[model samples]
Target: MKVFKIVRVLFFISFFSFAQNEDYVKENYNKTETTITMRDGIKLFTVIYAPKDTSKEYPILLQRTPYSCQPYGEDAFRTKIAPNEFLMKEGNIVVYQDVRGRWMSEGVYDNMRAYIPNKKGKQIDEASDTYDSIDWLVKNIPNNNGNVGIWGISYPGFYATYSLLDSHPALKAVSPQASIGDFFFDDFHHNGAYLLSYWRVTPLFGHEKTQPTAKPWFNFPDLGTEDQYQFFLDAGPLSNLDAYYKEDNVFWQQLKDHPNYDDFWKSRGIIQHLKNVKPAVMFVGGFFDAEDLYGPFNSYQAVEKNSSNYNTIVFGPWSHGDWARNSERQSIGNVYFGDSISHTYQKNIETTFFNNFLKNNTQVTVKLPEAYMFDTGLNQWEQYEQWPPKNTEKKSYFLQNNQRLNTHAEKSFTFEEFVSDPKKPVPYSEDIKMVFTPRKYMTDDQRFAARRPDVLVFETPILTEDITMAGPILAKLKVSTTGTDADWVVKVIDVFPSDAADFPETQAYLKMDNYFMMVRSEVMRGRFRNSFSIPEAFIPNEKTAVSIKLQDVNHTFKKGHKIQVQVQSTWFPLIDLNPQTFVPNIFEAKATDFKKQTHRVYNDSSIEFTVLKKK
Candidate 1:
């Protein structure tokens, strides 16, 4: 045991050291700082790390981000540059830039800046900014091959996607990993429902800086207690947040102004503009990504539909940005996957992708699959010729009386009733502590929620055979609410066998005994069932059909594992509490709007799973 522990420690030490060694980056590359002027005469701060070898020219890899390109001075060096250490070793001229109006850049910052299709005079947007930046880098930067590639993880990923639109001639390849294509469906809002958990970042992007500074002008509110469920509940209606945010926060004000998806959000969506993509594009996302899952999937689909570009997608069983940062891809929270899964992806997929396009390396002949995804249940990587592979068949599981899920529809009319109270909303996870971003809740055990009177649980008989589900999940629910307005939260979970044992690595913190792991879930504002642009009231007790589209899932329920569905009106703190009463603007809803109401989900309702039938 002692010898094993020593070997394990040494393995990780060696793994990370080789992957992200600060000494290695500095020794091989020379760092230079420059301020590149945009089309509108706005100067943006940028950092360039060029290979010391003057014998050969290297391709320029750029990442534009709202997040600061830190270690400002030319003398100071970042811990590492490029997405992986292999790229640094391959000797590329990597660049990092602070977008206009952010961190030493002279301009104004617009949150998810609306793309300007037709620009006259000195007009500029993220796409134009990218063009100007790329054009400047290839021309001015020393010892740079004309070829350029752009990539970034989260917000930076958004910028990378923007680059694909009206791409520069020099831009050869681009990867947008966990990038948000639309704000309404991606980050702050999911299907027109506000993600209350992200309210913590109100100060991060909300505040307007008078000058280009290295540090954030504002600080996040320090919640006295770690229990966000209690904290948000005590705060009352969503309007209560105005007390802290005030009027100066433009982004928060925009949320209030745009109660419904309208021209404002439509203009900000980058997916529609992904037409005529010139560069070879790779869209990356995590299946369990709490944030921005909609972005990568939708962006890839849009490109595939509209543009004739070489596009592919990669999704792993990882949390937001986990594939890029985590060395231990073996598990997320209590769930244990195979070891070095992330390392394998980085070494095999990401590195090879860049080398083929940017470096023009013909030796790397590996053709990446069109859809390279990790099956969560099988815990292995699978490649498909097309996403939502042509082989899948749509299967419907009907919700029945007595907490049951069956393939056949129930002939008799029956319903499960739950009283939803805004004051005492359902907690998203069993854990009491507040997470700034509720990530683990994506795969959290649903036992606590199953026991809740307000949450309705429906389950299938233990699967006799492995049921593999791929692609999108649709929840067509026939629901009626006593109140005029409400929010419908649907969760698809995998129930572990009763005799299941915990893995050795997670024995201390996890127990698999009848564990209910959430596979895919989504929320829909009841008012927006018909249309997101306009909201309609429920008309009290009238039955309404709400179609809630859960994000794409590639999970398999192994034999003996039961597939479960959980339905609830409120997923508090994770999503802002719906007042229950109809309000034109939920952000401006009054305290009186918060009330207890009974919600009924009929047996006729069904969940559609894209099942991959075995040969």
Candidate 2:
């Protein structure tokens, strides 16, 4: 009892120390507000926080965001800055800016503003805006060092990515943490399937502002009931959403305009323009991140293909921005990934990355491994010279008779069929409450989904050995649908033992017995099975190959735990329901376009996993 009391006291002391450090930094720093003008003559609002002690030169860490840098006045300071308390105590000049047309900034706001490659007079893009901002900072901000480093999460992360293109020479290091690479693949849509959960935040992006203001011009509507799934179902059809959003919402109108991966979305993608990146880049993402997983992974690949800069990636067992926020409690949903996993990353990887490049911390050289990824199955961090670790062997898990997953293919020429009804689409979660974002669903238990008649469940025998997957998971299916169009939802799950016991850290409400934890999942619209640019309808009863590339997963199916694969046609309120009819523009589809379809998955269909061999 004495030991327990002593340990509890020490824990609070340690936590207090970190909090005190953050408070001290805030007390010591001076906040100043200024406007930086872009080449197009639009002025952007910026907040600069410099330490009171000018004892030594500090590098500039700038972050540009469409999300307002609140506490507008010069006297008001942010309580915490620089990713975590570690970097804040390191004493760097932290700069935050409201990107053009956001908050106090002046100009017309554009969503994921397309980058203009060859600009004539008065033409501008996000890259040019970034260049101008950095140029202004170096000239105006009275800092000792010329070195500039930029980093951001989510949309701000998008700005960080854009800064890489035509990067300023002064911009030395950049970390696009959970960055959005493409609108079509990342946040809003995945392989042409719209994320219905994002509908809540659409008003935040869609509404136009008459002038730059501190508060939001338009507010997200309160979806009357707590049950969003039922609300969305009652709302009926994607076309009906416009009635609530109205025509004034430019972004809503834009979504209606471009139903396909047309030139508009193509030009907005930063991957194509990521050539010859000069900044020292470290792309960070989460293996379990529900949103923007496509960004960091694809951005890293694009950079590797285009540039030779000191580029690296770090994918932790985290949700969107979990590393920054939930530093002490390292868990997503019910899956506890050990304590201080996020703090370890912030102190060791992130802070070290910035200090090495920005502060020139000579104790450790800035040369890092190509990838520093967390293995969720093993609950350990692994560093590799290359991603998808070259030591992996490709293994295919074929769907066989009696809903089993085996290495050997079943040549019975049989298929599993289920009737998919749009009216009663399978809910993404069993939970009844509403949320702006369904982040926990990324790791939520799938036992509820497996019992659904419309979903196909396949599982491997309780693993005799620990099977670890290291890289991307590809699902290749030979399927036939009764309707002209459909959406394929694939889930990779880890089924706990029937007699499993909950860990001490597990949430009280979560039951460990027969737990089915989702590791990786993806949705692909059937029409885009051929091409995202063109919509192709499925011929009735004709077997077609539909390939779905699930996000990269670093997980282990522990010994005694079963590996389960769930295939379903609908994930309602999470992904927009497919009308299951040949509609050129799904955004404009009528309620009658929605229909019931029988989808068949052949026995020959299989999922390929990149399994890592144990050392």
Among these predictions, the greatest lDDT belongs to: 1
Q: For residues 328-420, what per-residue lDDT tens digits would candidate 1 score against the true structure?
A: 546666787777777788888998888888777423367899999999998999999999988999999999999999999978999999999
Positional deviation of 221 in candidate 2, in angstroms?
Answer: 0.9
Give the least accurate 10-residue stretch of model 2, judged by summed lDDT: 7-16
In terms of TM-score, how similar is model 1 to the real structure? 0.96
In candidate 1, stretches whose alpha carbon ends up further than 4 angstroms from where it belongs are 1-18, 361-364, 504-510
259: Cα error in model 1, Å: 1.3
TM-score of each: 0.96, 0.95
Q: Write the per-residue lDDT of candidate 2 for residues 1-615, one digit (tens) a residue.
A: 242232223212111223544357568898888888888888899889898888778889988887678667776666677666788887889888988877789998899999988778889888888898889888887764888899998888899999998888889889998899999998889999998888877876888787878776776666689899999999988888877788888888888899899999998899888889998889999888888899998899889989998889999888877777544667887787877887888888888888887778322375677899998978898889888799999899997757898888966788899999998999988878776566778888898889989999999999999998989999999899999999999999999998977766556777889899999999999999989999899999999999999989888899999999999999989889899998999988899999999999999999999999888
Report lDDT (CA) for all predictions: 0.86, 0.85
